[model samples]
Target: MAKKARVRDYDQFIVRLPPGMRDRIKDKAERAGMSMNEAIVWCLEREFPAPVTLEDRLEELATMVSMLTDSKDTYSGVVHLIAEIEETLDAIGTKGGIPADTKFSDMVRERLDYWREIELDSWRDRNESPFDDANWTSVEEPPEGDPFPNLPDDEMKKD
Candidate 1:
Protein backbone atom coordinates (compact mmCIF):
# COMPACT_ATOMS: atom_id res chain seq x y z
CA MET A 1 0.00 0.00 0.00
CA ALA A 2 1.19 3.53 -0.68
CA LYS A 3 2.02 5.77 2.25
CA LYS A 4 -0.42 8.59 3.11
CA ALA A 5 0.69 12.08 2.12
CA ARG A 6 2.00 14.26 4.96
CA VAL A 7 -0.33 17.10 5.89
CA ARG A 8 1.09 20.62 5.55
CA ASP A 9 -0.77 22.94 7.90
CA TYR A 10 1.24 26.05 7.09
CA ASP A 11 0.03 29.57 7.88
CA GLN A 12 -0.27 31.90 4.87
CA PHE A 13 1.01 35.41 4.51
CA ILE A 14 0.77 37.81 1.55
CA VAL A 15 4.02 39.80 1.53
CA ARG A 16 4.64 42.94 -0.49
CA LEU A 17 8.23 43.02 -1.73
CA PRO A 18 9.78 46.26 -2.93
CA PRO A 19 11.22 46.73 -6.46
CA GLY A 20 13.77 43.95 -7.16
CA MET A 21 13.28 41.98 -3.92
CA ARG A 22 10.60 39.75 -5.43
CA ASP A 23 12.87 38.89 -8.34
CA ARG A 24 15.73 38.17 -5.95
CA ILE A 25 13.60 35.76 -3.93
CA LYS A 26 12.42 34.12 -7.13
CA ASP A 27 16.01 33.78 -8.35
CA LYS A 28 17.08 32.24 -5.03
CA ALA A 29 14.16 29.84 -5.18
CA GLU A 30 15.12 28.86 -8.68
CA ARG A 31 18.80 28.42 -7.84
CA ALA A 32 18.00 26.27 -4.82
CA GLY A 33 15.27 24.54 -6.86
CA MET A 34 12.75 25.11 -4.10
CA SER A 35 9.37 26.78 -3.99
CA MET A 36 9.39 30.54 -3.29
CA ASN A 37 7.63 29.85 0.00
CA GLU A 38 10.26 27.29 1.01
CA ALA A 39 13.09 29.68 0.10
CA ILE A 40 11.49 32.49 2.09
CA VAL A 41 10.96 30.26 5.12
CA TRP A 42 14.58 29.08 4.93
CA CYS A 43 15.81 32.68 4.95
CA LEU A 44 13.53 33.55 7.85
CA GLU A 45 14.69 30.57 9.86
CA ARG A 46 18.36 31.51 9.31
CA GLU A 47 17.68 35.13 10.24
CA PHE A 48 15.65 34.42 13.39
CA PRO A 49 16.87 31.13 14.75
CA ALA A 50 15.37 29.50 17.84
CA PRO A 51 16.74 30.57 21.20
CA VAL A 52 19.73 28.55 22.42
CA THR A 53 18.72 26.50 25.44
CA LEU A 54 20.98 26.72 28.49
CA GLU A 55 22.04 23.12 27.93
CA ASP A 56 22.91 23.87 24.31
CA ARG A 57 24.88 26.97 25.30
CA LEU A 58 26.85 25.05 27.89
CA GLU A 59 27.53 22.29 25.38
CA GLU A 60 28.87 24.81 22.85
CA LEU A 61 31.08 26.49 25.44
CA ALA A 62 32.37 23.14 26.62
CA THR A 63 33.19 22.08 23.09
CA MET A 64 35.09 25.32 22.39
CA VAL A 65 37.05 25.19 25.65
CA SER A 66 37.95 21.53 25.26
CA MET A 67 39.21 22.03 21.72
CA LEU A 68 41.13 25.14 22.74
CA THR A 69 42.78 23.34 25.65
CA ASP A 70 43.98 20.56 23.39
CA SER A 71 45.49 22.92 20.84
CA LYS A 72 48.39 25.35 21.05
CA ASP A 73 45.89 27.81 19.52
CA THR A 74 42.71 25.76 18.88
CA TYR A 75 43.28 22.13 17.74
CA SER A 76 41.69 22.58 14.32
CA GLY A 77 40.71 26.23 14.33
CA VAL A 78 40.07 26.36 10.54
CA VAL A 79 37.67 23.44 10.58
CA HIS A 80 36.13 24.71 13.80
CA LEU A 81 35.57 28.13 12.28
CA ILE A 82 34.11 26.64 9.09
CA ALA A 83 31.82 24.49 11.21
CA GLU A 84 30.85 27.56 13.20
CA ILE A 85 29.73 29.70 10.22
CA GLU A 86 26.91 32.06 11.22
CA GLU A 87 24.50 30.85 8.51
CA THR A 88 22.95 27.52 7.68
CA LEU A 89 23.25 26.22 4.10
CA ASP A 90 20.10 24.13 4.07
CA ALA A 91 18.95 25.42 0.68
CA ILE A 92 22.28 24.89 -1.06
CA GLY A 93 21.24 22.41 -3.73
CA THR A 94 17.76 20.90 -3.68
CA LYS A 95 14.48 20.78 -1.77
CA GLY A 96 16.10 18.67 0.96
CA GLY A 97 19.15 21.00 1.14
CA ILE A 98 21.36 18.00 0.49
CA PRO A 99 21.46 16.19 -2.87
CA ALA A 100 18.24 14.27 -3.53
CA ASP A 101 20.17 10.99 -3.96
CA THR A 102 22.32 11.46 -0.86
CA LYS A 103 21.60 10.71 2.78
CA PHE A 104 23.00 12.95 5.51
CA SER A 105 24.60 10.01 7.36
CA ASP A 106 26.43 8.98 4.18
CA MET A 107 28.07 12.37 3.61
CA VAL A 108 31.79 12.90 4.18
CA ARG A 109 32.54 13.88 7.78
CA GLU A 110 35.84 14.99 9.31
CA ARG A 111 35.08 14.93 13.00
CA LEU A 112 37.06 16.14 16.03
CA ASP A 113 35.06 15.39 19.13
CA TYR A 114 36.20 16.80 22.46
CA TRP A 115 33.19 15.73 24.48
CA ARG A 116 30.05 13.70 24.03
CA GLU A 117 26.50 13.16 25.26
CA ILE A 118 25.13 9.91 23.83
CA GLU A 119 21.47 10.86 24.42
CA LEU A 120 21.65 13.81 22.03
CA ASP A 121 21.83 13.19 18.27
CA SER A 122 23.33 16.64 17.64
CA TRP A 123 26.15 15.88 20.05
CA ARG A 124 26.70 12.49 18.44
CA ASP A 125 26.90 14.09 14.99
CA ARG A 126 29.75 16.31 16.20
CA ASN A 127 31.75 13.18 17.18
CA GLU A 128 31.84 11.54 20.60
CA SER A 129 34.41 11.37 23.38
CA PRO A 130 34.17 10.38 27.03
CA PHE A 131 33.22 13.38 29.19
CA ASP A 132 35.69 14.72 31.78
CA ASP A 133 34.58 17.08 34.55
CA ALA A 134 38.08 18.52 34.93
CA ASN A 135 37.83 20.19 31.50
CA TRP A 136 35.13 22.57 32.68
CA THR A 137 35.28 26.08 34.15
CA SER A 138 32.54 27.94 36.05
CA VAL A 139 31.19 31.10 34.38
CA GLU A 140 30.84 32.75 37.82
CA GLU A 141 34.60 32.79 38.39
CA PRO A 142 36.75 33.55 35.34
CA PRO A 143 40.58 33.39 35.29
CA GLU A 144 42.28 36.45 36.76
CA GLY A 145 44.99 38.85 35.41
CA ASP A 146 45.87 41.02 32.44
CA PRO A 147 49.15 40.26 30.70
CA PHE A 148 49.37 43.78 29.30
CA PRO A 149 47.90 46.40 31.63
CA ASN A 150 50.08 49.28 30.41
CA LEU A 151 51.11 48.92 26.77
CA PRO A 152 53.77 51.29 25.23
CA ASP A 153 54.52 52.52 28.79
CA ASP A 154 56.22 49.65 30.65
CA GLU A 155 59.61 48.88 29.18
CA MET A 156 61.00 45.35 29.29
CA LYS A 157 64.66 44.51 30.01
CA LYS A 158 66.53 41.91 27.95
CA ASP A 159 67.60 39.26 30.42
Candidate 2:
Protein backbone atom coordinates (compact mmCIF):
# COMPACT_ATOMS: atom_id res chain seq x y z
CA MET A 1 0.00 0.00 0.00
CA ALA A 2 1.23 3.56 -0.92
CA LYS A 3 1.75 6.00 1.98
CA LYS A 4 -0.80 8.90 2.05
CA ALA A 5 1.40 11.99 2.43
CA ARG A 6 -0.33 14.87 4.24
CA VAL A 7 -1.01 17.83 1.85
CA ARG A 8 -1.09 20.42 4.67
CA ASP A 9 2.43 20.88 6.14
CA TYR A 10 1.52 23.56 8.77
CA ASP A 11 1.04 22.63 12.45
CA GLN A 12 -2.67 22.33 13.44
CA PHE A 13 -4.16 24.53 16.21
CA ILE A 14 -7.53 24.14 18.03
CA VAL A 15 -10.11 26.94 17.52
CA ARG A 16 -13.25 27.22 19.71
CA LEU A 17 -16.45 28.27 17.86
CA PRO A 18 -19.79 29.38 19.37
CA PRO A 19 -22.83 27.10 19.11
CA GLY A 20 -24.18 26.86 15.52
CA MET A 21 -21.02 28.65 14.22
CA ARG A 22 -19.47 25.32 13.26
CA ASP A 23 -22.60 24.38 11.27
CA ARG A 24 -22.60 27.83 9.53
CA ILE A 25 -18.93 27.40 8.66
CA LYS A 26 -19.65 23.90 7.34
CA ASP A 27 -22.49 25.27 5.16
CA LYS A 28 -20.25 28.05 3.81
CA ALA A 29 -17.44 25.55 3.14
CA GLU A 30 -19.84 23.28 1.18
CA ARG A 31 -21.12 26.29 -0.83
CA ALA A 32 -17.57 27.41 -1.59
CA GLY A 33 -16.48 23.83 -2.50
CA MET A 34 -13.76 24.03 0.19
CA SER A 35 -12.95 22.22 3.43
CA MET A 36 -13.93 23.93 6.76
CA ASN A 37 -10.33 24.92 7.42
CA GLU A 38 -9.89 26.26 3.85
CA ALA A 39 -13.19 28.22 4.04
CA ILE A 40 -12.20 29.77 7.42
CA VAL A 41 -8.79 30.76 6.06
CA TRP A 42 -10.38 32.22 2.88
CA CYS A 43 -12.92 34.22 4.90
CA LEU A 44 -10.23 35.58 7.23
CA GLU A 45 -7.97 36.50 4.28
CA ARG A 46 -10.83 38.32 2.52
CA GLU A 47 -11.87 40.16 5.73
CA PHE A 48 -8.28 41.25 6.42
CA PRO A 49 -6.55 41.57 3.01
CA ALA A 50 -3.19 43.26 2.34
CA PRO A 51 -2.99 46.96 3.26
CA VAL A 52 -2.63 49.48 0.40
CA THR A 53 0.13 52.11 0.66
CA LEU A 54 -0.49 55.86 0.05
CA GLU A 55 1.89 55.68 -2.98
CA ASP A 56 -0.32 52.96 -4.59
CA ARG A 57 -3.49 55.09 -4.12
CA LEU A 58 -1.75 58.23 -5.46
CA GLU A 59 -0.53 56.33 -8.54
CA GLU A 60 -4.04 54.98 -9.20
CA LEU A 61 -5.52 58.51 -8.84
CA ALA A 62 -2.85 59.96 -11.14
CA THR A 63 -3.62 57.31 -13.82
CA MET A 64 -7.37 58.05 -13.52
CA VAL A 65 -6.80 61.83 -13.77
CA SER A 66 -4.49 61.40 -16.76
CA MET A 67 -7.10 59.25 -18.58
CA LEU A 68 -9.87 61.80 -17.84
CA THR A 69 -7.71 64.75 -18.95
CA ASP A 70 -6.84 62.97 -22.22
CA SER A 71 -10.50 62.11 -22.84
CA LYS A 72 -11.56 65.72 -22.12
CA ASP A 73 -9.01 67.13 -24.56
CA THR A 74 -10.00 64.64 -27.30
CA TYR A 75 -13.76 65.13 -26.75
CA SER A 76 -13.52 68.92 -26.79
CA GLY A 77 -12.43 68.83 -30.45
CA VAL A 78 -14.98 66.05 -31.16
CA VAL A 79 -17.83 68.24 -29.80
CA HIS A 80 -16.87 71.13 -32.09
CA LEU A 81 -16.46 68.77 -35.06
CA ILE A 82 -19.86 67.18 -34.39
CA ALA A 83 -21.46 70.65 -34.18
CA GLU A 84 -19.89 71.62 -37.50
CA ILE A 85 -21.08 68.35 -39.10
CA GLU A 86 -24.64 68.95 -37.77
CA GLU A 87 -24.60 72.50 -39.12
CA THR A 88 -23.40 71.27 -42.50
CA LEU A 89 -26.13 68.62 -42.58
CA ASP A 90 -28.75 71.26 -41.58
CA ALA A 91 -27.52 73.54 -44.37
CA ILE A 92 -28.02 70.68 -46.85
CA GLY A 93 -31.70 70.44 -45.66
CA THR A 94 -31.33 67.07 -43.92
CA LYS A 95 -30.78 65.74 -40.42
CA GLY A 96 -27.61 63.70 -39.75
CA GLY A 97 -29.09 60.39 -40.91
CA ILE A 98 -29.75 58.36 -44.05
CA PRO A 99 -32.49 60.06 -46.10
CA ALA A 100 -35.41 57.82 -47.16
CA ASP A 101 -36.20 59.96 -50.17
CA THR A 102 -33.84 59.60 -53.12
CA LYS A 103 -34.46 63.24 -54.12
CA PHE A 104 -33.28 64.50 -50.73
CA SER A 105 -30.21 62.26 -50.92
CA ASP A 106 -29.44 63.65 -54.36
CA MET A 107 -29.85 67.18 -53.04
CA VAL A 108 -27.49 66.46 -50.14
CA ARG A 109 -24.97 64.89 -52.54
CA GLU A 110 -25.16 67.94 -54.82
CA ARG A 111 -24.67 70.33 -51.90
CA LEU A 112 -21.68 68.29 -50.67
CA ASP A 113 -20.20 68.27 -54.19
CA TYR A 114 -20.63 72.05 -54.50
CA TRP A 115 -19.10 72.60 -51.07
CA ARG A 116 -16.15 70.37 -51.91
CA GLU A 117 -15.54 72.30 -55.14
CA ILE A 118 -15.55 75.70 -53.47
CA GLU A 119 -13.84 74.65 -50.20
CA LEU A 120 -10.21 74.67 -51.38
CA ASP A 121 -10.78 77.66 -53.71
CA SER A 122 -12.25 79.67 -50.84
CA TRP A 123 -9.24 78.83 -48.68
CA ARG A 124 -6.84 79.77 -51.48
CA ASP A 125 -8.72 83.03 -52.25
CA ARG A 126 -8.91 84.14 -48.62
CA ASN A 127 -8.31 87.90 -48.23
CA GLU A 128 -4.96 88.04 -46.40
CA SER A 129 -5.35 91.84 -46.18
CA PRO A 130 -7.88 91.37 -43.30
CA PHE A 131 -5.07 89.82 -41.22
CA ASP A 132 -2.63 92.63 -42.18
CA ASP A 133 -2.26 95.52 -39.72
CA ALA A 134 -1.79 97.94 -42.70
CA ASN A 135 -5.35 97.17 -43.86
CA TRP A 136 -6.84 97.63 -40.34
CA THR A 137 -8.00 101.05 -39.18
CA SER A 138 -6.55 102.08 -35.81
CA VAL A 139 -9.18 102.93 -33.18
CA GLU A 140 -9.19 106.69 -32.47
CA GLU A 141 -10.12 108.00 -28.99
CA PRO A 142 -13.59 109.58 -28.71
CA PRO A 143 -13.76 113.38 -29.31
CA GLU A 144 -13.07 115.50 -26.15
CA GLY A 145 -16.60 116.96 -26.42
CA ASP A 146 -19.50 114.55 -25.81
CA PRO A 147 -21.44 113.76 -29.04
CA PHE A 148 -24.67 114.17 -27.01
CA PRO A 149 -23.68 117.54 -25.48
CA ASN A 150 -27.31 118.75 -25.52
CA LEU A 151 -28.51 115.79 -23.42
CA PRO A 152 -28.69 116.35 -19.64
CA ASP A 153 -27.46 113.73 -17.11
CA ASP A 154 -31.08 113.32 -15.82
CA GLU A 155 -32.34 112.70 -19.39
CA MET A 156 -29.60 110.10 -19.98
CA LYS A 157 -30.55 108.36 -16.69
CA LYS A 158 -34.28 108.07 -17.69
CA ASP A 159 -35.58 104.52 -18.14
Candidate 3:
Protein backbone atom coordinates (compact mmCIF):
# COMPACT_ATOMS: atom_id res chain seq x y z
CA MET A 1 0.00 0.00 0.00
CA ALA A 2 1.22 3.53 -0.87
CA LYS A 3 2.03 5.59 2.28
CA LYS A 4 -0.20 8.68 2.80
CA ALA A 5 1.61 12.00 2.16
CA ARG A 6 2.02 14.57 4.97
CA VAL A 7 -0.39 17.55 4.67
CA ARG A 8 0.57 21.04 6.01
CA ASP A 9 -1.81 23.96 6.65
CA TYR A 10 1.06 26.51 6.54
CA ASP A 11 1.96 28.36 3.32
CA GLN A 12 5.29 27.38 1.72
CA PHE A 13 8.01 29.99 1.12
CA ILE A 14 11.34 29.87 -0.76
CA VAL A 15 14.24 31.90 0.66
CA ARG A 16 18.01 32.34 0.22
CA LEU A 17 20.24 32.36 3.32
CA PRO A 18 23.71 33.88 3.91
CA PRO A 19 26.85 31.69 3.73
CA GLY A 20 27.02 28.87 6.36
CA MET A 21 23.38 29.67 7.43
CA ARG A 22 22.13 26.42 5.80
CA ASP A 23 24.70 24.39 7.78
CA ARG A 24 23.72 26.20 11.03
CA ILE A 25 20.06 25.32 10.40
CA LYS A 26 21.02 21.71 9.73
CA ASP A 27 23.09 21.57 12.98
CA LYS A 28 20.24 23.10 15.03
CA ALA A 29 17.74 20.62 13.48
CA GLU A 30 20.07 17.67 14.29
CA ARG A 31 20.65 18.83 17.89
CA ALA A 32 16.91 19.45 18.47
CA GLY A 33 15.83 16.26 16.56
CA MET A 34 13.60 18.23 14.19
CA SER A 35 13.54 19.02 10.45
CA MET A 36 15.55 22.01 9.09
CA ASN A 37 12.23 23.81 8.32
CA GLU A 38 11.13 23.29 11.97
CA ALA A 39 14.46 24.62 13.26
CA ILE A 40 14.11 27.73 11.07
CA VAL A 41 10.52 28.27 12.27
CA TRP A 42 11.59 27.77 15.91
CA CYS A 43 14.42 30.29 15.55
CA LEU A 44 12.08 32.83 13.94
CA GLU A 45 9.46 32.38 16.67
CA ARG A 46 12.10 32.76 19.39
CA GLU A 47 13.55 35.95 17.86
CA PHE A 48 10.10 37.48 17.35
CA PRO A 49 7.51 36.71 20.01
CA ALA A 50 3.73 36.93 19.47
CA PRO A 51 2.20 40.38 19.96
CA VAL A 52 0.19 40.95 23.15
CA THR A 53 -3.55 41.27 22.46
CA LEU A 54 -5.95 43.62 24.29
CA GLU A 55 -7.22 40.75 26.43
CA ASP A 56 -3.64 39.76 27.32
CA ARG A 57 -2.85 43.37 28.32
CA LEU A 58 -5.99 43.53 30.50
CA GLU A 59 -5.09 40.26 32.20
CA GLU A 60 -1.57 41.54 32.90
CA LEU A 61 -3.00 44.75 34.38
CA ALA A 62 -5.43 42.73 36.51
CA THR A 63 -2.54 40.63 37.86
CA MET A 64 -0.58 43.77 38.74
CA VAL A 65 -3.62 45.21 40.56
CA SER A 66 -3.98 42.00 42.57
CA MET A 67 -0.28 42.12 43.48
CA LEU A 68 -0.67 45.73 44.62
CA THR A 69 -3.66 44.81 46.80
CA ASP A 70 -1.55 42.10 48.47
CA SER A 71 1.28 44.58 49.00
CA LYS A 72 -1.13 47.06 50.62
CA ASP A 73 -2.40 44.40 53.01
CA THR A 74 1.21 43.52 53.96
CA TYR A 75 2.09 47.18 54.39
CA SER A 76 -0.86 47.81 56.71
CA GLY A 77 0.09 44.77 58.78
CA VAL A 78 3.67 46.05 59.20
CA VAL A 79 2.46 49.53 60.14
CA HIS A 80 0.16 48.09 62.81
CA LEU A 81 3.06 45.96 64.15
CA ILE A 82 5.27 49.04 64.54
CA ALA A 83 2.48 50.88 66.35
CA GLU A 84 2.04 47.90 68.71
CA ILE A 85 5.78 47.97 69.49
CA GLU A 86 5.63 51.69 70.31
CA GLU A 87 2.68 51.13 72.63
CA THR A 88 4.46 48.24 74.34
CA LEU A 89 7.60 50.31 74.90
CA ASP A 90 5.48 53.11 76.39
CA ALA A 91 3.65 50.67 78.65
CA ILE A 92 6.94 49.14 79.79
CA GLY A 93 8.40 52.53 80.66
CA THR A 94 5.29 53.49 82.68
CA LYS A 95 4.88 50.12 84.39
CA GLY A 96 8.41 48.86 85.36
CA GLY A 97 11.30 49.27 82.93
CA ILE A 98 12.93 46.17 81.45
CA PRO A 99 16.10 44.82 83.07
CA ALA A 100 19.40 45.82 81.44
CA ASP A 101 20.33 42.17 80.74
CA THR A 102 17.04 41.29 79.03
CA LYS A 103 17.75 39.33 75.83
CA PHE A 104 16.43 40.48 72.42
CA SER A 105 14.45 37.22 72.16
CA ASP A 106 12.66 38.09 75.42
CA MET A 107 11.70 41.48 74.02
CA VAL A 108 10.43 39.84 70.81
CA ARG A 109 8.40 37.31 72.82
CA GLU A 110 7.01 40.10 75.02
CA ARG A 111 6.03 42.10 71.93
CA LEU A 112 4.27 39.07 70.46
CA ASP A 113 2.42 38.44 73.73
CA TYR A 114 1.51 42.08 74.02
CA TRP A 115 0.13 41.93 70.47
CA ARG A 116 -1.90 38.82 71.18
CA GLU A 117 -3.35 39.31 74.68
CA ILE A 118 -2.72 42.85 75.89
CA GLU A 119 -3.07 44.76 72.62
CA LEU A 120 -6.89 45.18 72.60
CA ASP A 121 -6.97 45.56 76.36
CA SER A 122 -4.25 48.16 76.25
CA TRP A 123 -6.25 50.11 73.69
CA ARG A 124 -9.30 49.97 75.96
CA ASP A 125 -7.20 51.14 78.94
CA ARG A 126 -5.91 54.07 76.88
CA ASN A 127 -9.50 54.89 75.70
CA GLU A 128 -8.51 54.16 72.06
CA SER A 129 -10.98 52.48 69.75
CA PRO A 130 -10.21 48.78 69.21
CA PHE A 131 -11.09 49.20 65.52
CA ASP A 132 -12.93 45.97 66.25
CA ASP A 133 -14.46 45.88 62.81
CA ALA A 134 -11.06 45.92 61.12
CA ASN A 135 -8.84 44.16 63.65
CA TRP A 136 -5.30 43.07 62.63
CA THR A 137 -5.73 39.76 64.47
CA SER A 138 -8.61 38.90 62.16
CA VAL A 139 -6.62 39.92 59.06
CA GLU A 140 -3.11 38.55 59.77
CA GLU A 141 -1.91 36.82 62.92
CA PRO A 142 1.65 37.54 64.08
CA PRO A 143 4.31 34.84 63.77
CA GLU A 144 5.06 32.80 66.93
CA GLY A 145 8.78 32.24 66.27
CA ASP A 146 11.61 33.38 63.98
CA PRO A 147 10.10 33.36 60.48
CA PHE A 148 13.47 32.86 58.80
CA PRO A 149 15.36 30.79 61.36
CA ASN A 150 18.89 29.63 60.52
CA LEU A 151 18.07 26.02 61.46
CA PRO A 152 16.96 23.61 58.74
CA ASP A 153 13.46 22.02 58.71
CA ASP A 154 14.65 18.72 60.24
CA GLU A 155 16.86 20.39 62.87
CA MET A 156 14.10 22.69 64.11
CA LYS A 157 11.70 21.38 66.76
CA LYS A 158 8.06 21.49 65.71
CA ASP A 159 5.23 22.21 68.16
Candidate 4:
Protein backbone atom coordinates (compact mmCIF):
# COMPACT_ATOMS: atom_id res chain seq x y z
CA MET A 1 0.00 0.00 0.00
CA ALA A 2 1.12 3.61 -0.75
CA LYS A 3 0.09 7.00 0.58
CA LYS A 4 -2.45 8.83 -1.60
CA ALA A 5 -1.97 12.47 -2.58
CA ARG A 6 -4.80 14.86 -3.11
CA VAL A 7 -4.90 17.03 -6.22
CA ARG A 8 -6.73 20.33 -6.57
CA ASP A 9 -7.03 20.10 -10.40
CA TYR A 10 -5.69 17.63 -12.97
CA ASP A 11 -4.93 18.42 -16.58
CA GLN A 12 -6.56 16.24 -19.24
CA PHE A 13 -4.91 15.49 -22.62
CA ILE A 14 -6.00 13.39 -25.61
CA VAL A 15 -3.66 11.80 -28.17
CA ARG A 16 -4.07 9.29 -30.98
CA LEU A 17 -1.50 6.49 -31.42
CA PRO A 18 -1.13 3.53 -33.78
CA PRO A 19 -3.93 0.98 -33.42
CA GLY A 20 -3.36 -1.77 -30.75
CA MET A 21 -0.61 0.29 -29.01
CA ARG A 22 -3.04 1.50 -26.35
CA ASP A 23 -4.43 -1.99 -25.84
CA ARG A 24 -0.88 -3.39 -25.49
CA ILE A 25 0.02 -0.66 -22.96
CA LYS A 26 -3.15 -1.39 -20.95
CA ASP A 27 -2.36 -5.12 -20.95
CA LYS A 28 1.22 -4.46 -19.76
CA ALA A 29 -0.04 -2.15 -17.00
CA GLU A 30 -2.57 -4.75 -15.84
CA ARG A 31 0.17 -7.41 -15.78
CA ALA A 32 2.41 -5.11 -13.68
CA GLY A 33 -0.42 -4.55 -11.14
CA MET A 34 -0.59 -0.81 -11.93
CA SER A 35 -3.09 1.58 -13.43
CA MET A 36 -2.86 2.61 -17.12
CA ASN A 37 -1.84 6.19 -16.10
CA GLU A 38 1.04 4.88 -13.96
CA ALA A 39 2.19 2.53 -16.78
CA ILE A 40 2.02 5.39 -19.33
CA VAL A 41 4.11 7.61 -17.06
CA TRP A 42 6.71 4.87 -16.64
CA CYS A 43 6.80 4.18 -20.42
CA LEU A 44 7.11 7.90 -21.24
CA GLU A 45 9.97 8.24 -18.72
CA ARG A 46 11.83 5.41 -20.50
CA GLU A 47 10.98 6.47 -24.08
CA PHE A 48 11.81 10.17 -23.56
CA PRO A 49 15.28 9.81 -22.11
CA ALA A 50 17.18 12.74 -20.60
CA PRO A 51 19.97 13.88 -22.95
CA VAL A 52 23.38 14.44 -21.35
CA THR A 53 23.92 17.68 -23.27
CA LEU A 54 22.27 19.99 -25.82
CA GLU A 55 24.81 18.92 -28.45
CA ASP A 56 23.90 15.25 -27.95
CA ARG A 57 20.21 16.05 -28.44
CA LEU A 58 20.98 18.13 -31.51
CA GLU A 59 23.12 15.31 -32.99
CA GLU A 60 20.28 12.82 -32.43
CA LEU A 61 17.80 15.16 -34.16
CA ALA A 62 20.24 15.67 -37.05
CA THR A 63 20.66 11.90 -37.46
CA MET A 64 16.86 11.46 -37.49
CA VAL A 65 16.48 14.22 -40.12
CA SER A 66 19.26 12.68 -42.27
CA MET A 67 17.56 9.25 -42.08
CA LEU A 68 14.22 10.80 -43.12
CA THR A 69 15.90 12.66 -46.00
CA ASP A 70 17.66 9.46 -47.15
CA SER A 71 14.35 7.55 -47.06
CA LYS A 72 12.67 10.28 -49.16
CA ASP A 73 15.57 10.29 -51.64
CA THR A 74 15.47 6.50 -52.07
CA TYR A 75 11.67 6.57 -52.58
CA SER A 76 12.01 9.35 -55.18
CA GLY A 77 14.75 7.46 -57.05
CA VAL A 78 12.61 4.28 -57.17
CA VAL A 79 9.63 6.30 -58.42
CA HIS A 80 11.79 7.87 -61.14
CA LEU A 81 13.19 4.49 -62.17
CA ILE A 82 9.68 2.98 -62.38
CA ALA A 83 8.46 5.95 -64.50
CA GLU A 84 11.46 5.61 -66.83
CA ILE A 85 10.86 1.86 -67.20
CA GLU A 86 7.18 2.45 -67.94
CA GLU A 87 8.06 5.08 -70.54
CA THR A 88 10.57 2.77 -72.21
CA LEU A 89 8.03 -0.09 -72.26
CA ASP A 90 5.38 2.27 -73.68
CA ALA A 91 7.81 3.40 -76.41
CA ILE A 92 8.59 -0.22 -77.26
CA GLY A 93 4.89 -1.05 -77.39
CA THR A 94 4.20 1.92 -79.69
CA LYS A 95 7.11 1.01 -81.98
CA GLY A 96 5.92 -2.57 -82.13
CA GLY A 97 2.14 -3.12 -81.82
CA ILE A 98 -0.53 -3.60 -79.11
CA PRO A 99 -0.82 -7.41 -79.48
CA ALA A 100 2.82 -7.49 -80.78
CA ASP A 101 2.11 -9.49 -84.01
CA THR A 102 1.33 -12.74 -82.04
CA LYS A 103 4.16 -14.57 -83.87
CA PHE A 104 6.75 -12.05 -82.57
CA SER A 105 5.71 -12.44 -78.90
CA ASP A 106 5.50 -16.23 -79.32
CA MET A 107 8.95 -16.33 -80.94
CA VAL A 108 10.44 -14.01 -78.28
CA ARG A 109 8.86 -16.11 -75.50
CA GLU A 110 10.14 -19.35 -77.09
CA ARG A 111 13.65 -17.86 -77.44
CA LEU A 112 13.59 -16.77 -73.79
CA ASP A 113 12.44 -20.27 -72.76
CA TYR A 114 15.20 -21.78 -74.91
CA TRP A 115 17.81 -19.51 -73.27
CA ARG A 116 16.54 -20.55 -69.82
CA GLU A 117 16.72 -24.22 -70.84
CA ILE A 118 20.30 -23.72 -72.04
CA GLU A 119 21.24 -22.06 -68.71
CA LEU A 120 19.59 -24.94 -66.81
CA ASP A 121 21.58 -27.50 -68.81
CA SER A 122 24.84 -25.48 -68.82
CA TRP A 123 26.30 -27.41 -65.83
CA ARG A 124 24.90 -30.80 -66.96
CA ASP A 125 26.76 -33.43 -69.05
CA ARG A 126 24.37 -34.78 -71.71
CA ASN A 127 24.29 -38.45 -72.78
CA GLU A 128 25.35 -37.47 -76.32
CA SER A 129 28.40 -35.48 -75.04
CA PRO A 130 31.41 -37.78 -74.60
CA PHE A 131 33.31 -37.78 -71.29
CA ASP A 132 36.52 -36.27 -72.73
CA ASP A 133 39.59 -37.07 -70.57
CA ALA A 134 41.32 -33.87 -71.69
CA ASN A 135 42.78 -32.96 -68.29
CA TRP A 136 43.09 -36.53 -66.95
CA THR A 137 46.74 -37.34 -66.24
CA SER A 138 48.32 -39.59 -63.56
CA VAL A 139 51.04 -38.17 -61.25
CA GLU A 140 54.39 -40.05 -60.79
CA GLU A 141 54.61 -41.60 -57.29
CA PRO A 142 57.54 -42.79 -55.08
CA PRO A 143 58.17 -46.52 -54.46
CA GLU A 144 55.76 -48.17 -51.92
CA GLY A 145 57.05 -48.10 -48.27
CA ASP A 146 55.57 -48.73 -44.80
CA PRO A 147 53.80 -45.42 -43.81
CA PHE A 148 53.98 -46.24 -40.02
CA PRO A 149 57.17 -48.32 -39.71
CA ASN A 150 57.89 -47.22 -36.09
CA LEU A 151 54.34 -47.58 -34.69
CA PRO A 152 51.95 -50.55 -34.39
CA ASP A 153 48.12 -50.46 -34.01
CA ASP A 154 48.22 -52.66 -30.84
CA GLU A 155 50.77 -50.27 -29.18
CA MET A 156 48.78 -47.20 -30.17
CA LYS A 157 45.51 -48.58 -28.60
CA LYS A 158 44.82 -47.51 -24.96
CA ASP A 159 43.20 -49.76 -22.29
Better of 1 and 2 by lDDT: 2
Tens-digit lDDT string for candidate 2 (1-159):
557778686567799999999999999899989999999888787997655433453465456545656685755554454354444344442443322455654675677668767765775578554545566465654345665445678998894
Which portions of model 1 miss their true places by more than 4 Å?
1-24, 74-159
Location of the lowest summed lDDT over 10 successive residues in candidate 2: 91-100
Ranking by lDDT: 2, 3, 4, 1
Per-candidate total of colliding backbone pairs: 0, 0, 0, 0
Off by over 4 Å in 3: 1-7, 60-159
User: Which stretches of model 2 miss by more than 4 angstroms?
Assistant: 1-14, 45-49, 69-159
Q: Is candidate 2 or candidate 4 better by TM-score?
A: 2
Model 4 TM-score, all chains together: 0.25
What's the distance in Å from true for residue 111, model 3?
38
TM per prediction: 0.32, 0.30, 0.32, 0.25
**TM-score rank, highest first?**
3, 1, 2, 4
The whole-model lDDT of each prediction reads 0.53, 0.62, 0.61, 0.56
87, model 4: CA deviation in Å? 63
The residue-by-residue lDDT of candidate 1 on 16-79, one tens digit each, is: 8899998999998999999888899998999977654334544664677667776786546634
RMSD (CA, Å), each prediction: 19.4, 23.3, 25.6, 23.8
Residue pairs in candidate 3 whose N, alpha carbon or C atoms collide under 3 angstroms:
none
Which structure among the candidates has the greatest lDDT? 2
